[model samples]
Target: MLKKLILIALFSCSAHALDSNIIEIMQYLQRDSDLIQRGFFLNKFDIVQEGIEKHKVDFNTLQKFNIDMFLDEKHINYSPIISSFLRNIKENRIALEKFLKDNDKIRAYEAFQQLDYNCMKCHALVRGW
Candidate 1:
């Protein structure tokens, strides 16, 4: 809450200009991703595989939250872009799952790289970069 308040103050945003759910979701993903990346580097395929499923579920939850949060066009913000990004994340998660299940380390690395790229792209879009 203090972080949100600080962000609001820093950005000089209106009361409804911020979405707390998005911040929470991003933090969740960040932590999950750090684990997955660390696990991958340590050759802990099982850990990465498990974390991918969790991230998929979290991504889906975030999508549903966005749908509910932006159901009214009046409160639209950049939800359409966010929803699209979330869908991409879900798809990438599934591909990563399949890659790990197949024991294709090379492909799994590539998929994870793409997922990371998508994360950066979505962040840039959200921040109006």
Candidate 2:
């Protein structure tokens, strides 16, 4: 009877650990999605802004988070759809960063267009839309 109780306790602890890991994974996914949306909005503002004053809000928000934080492995999933989504986000970010550093609005806008398409594609693929 004692051995059975010990086994049951061990099983319960293992199940809890598994549940925690799953929750952690979901949180990471949510964080990545939020960051992507924020970046998208910032890039949009950068394109639309006619002057520094028009961009101040987006610029401040962008500056609040280290972009690198969004590029971590937590954003990726083993599934093909999720993997592609993450890869596209990373590529788009690189392109946008380069364009921004060069002060090239045209290229930045192009990159933003591609990023928007990627977002739609990922959503349709994942959500069956």
Candidate 3:
């Protein structure tokens, strides 16, 4: 009984920690996304580039966390969906970077929009909304 209690306590603490880490990651992503949007609207590719770099760090941190923590019977298929969204986001970022390098605001804007759409779609899936 004591061993079971200790295990439960440990598991609860770890689960809480993981939840906090995920929340932190989401907050950072949102901030970076806002920065990128502002930079785009203001015609400041440099700011957009900074946001992109920050987002890369955020993604690295997120990947470090055990995503299996987010899985359950209801979300058994979540992993593949997450991978697909990550791939789409990566491709969109690459296109955005290329467009910015070429100083093609129009294409960059389109890429940004696509990125936003991908993010929203993923959120909706996760939240079941």
Query: What TM-score quantifies how close candidate 3 is to the native fold?
Result: 0.91
Number of the predicted model whose lDDT against the real structure is largest:
3
* TM-score of every model versus the real structure: 0.71, 0.42, 0.91
Write model 2 residue lDDT over 44-124, tens digit each, in one string: 544333322222333334334333333336533425565565567557756866786688867865765676577577656
| Candidate 2 steric clashes | 0
When sorted by lDDT, best at the front, the candidate numbers are: 3, 1, 2
Q: 21-94, model 1: which lDDT tens digit per residue? A: 66777788887787789879999987886678678766766766534453455435666676676677777777
Tens-digit lDDT track of model 3 for 1-129: 999999999999999889988999989988988989999889787899999899888977877876667777787678788778877987888898899889898998899788878888888888889
Show the lowest summed lDDT stretch of 10 residues, model 3: 63-72
Model 3: how far residue 89 lies from native, Å = 0.9
Using TM-score, rank the candidates from best to worst: 3, 1, 2
- Please report, in order, the local distance difference test score of every candidate based on alpha carbons: 0.73, 0.55, 0.85
For candidate 3, the C-alpha RMSD (Å) to the true structure equals 1.4
All models, RMSD in angstroms: 7.4, 10.1, 1.4
TM-score of 1: 0.71
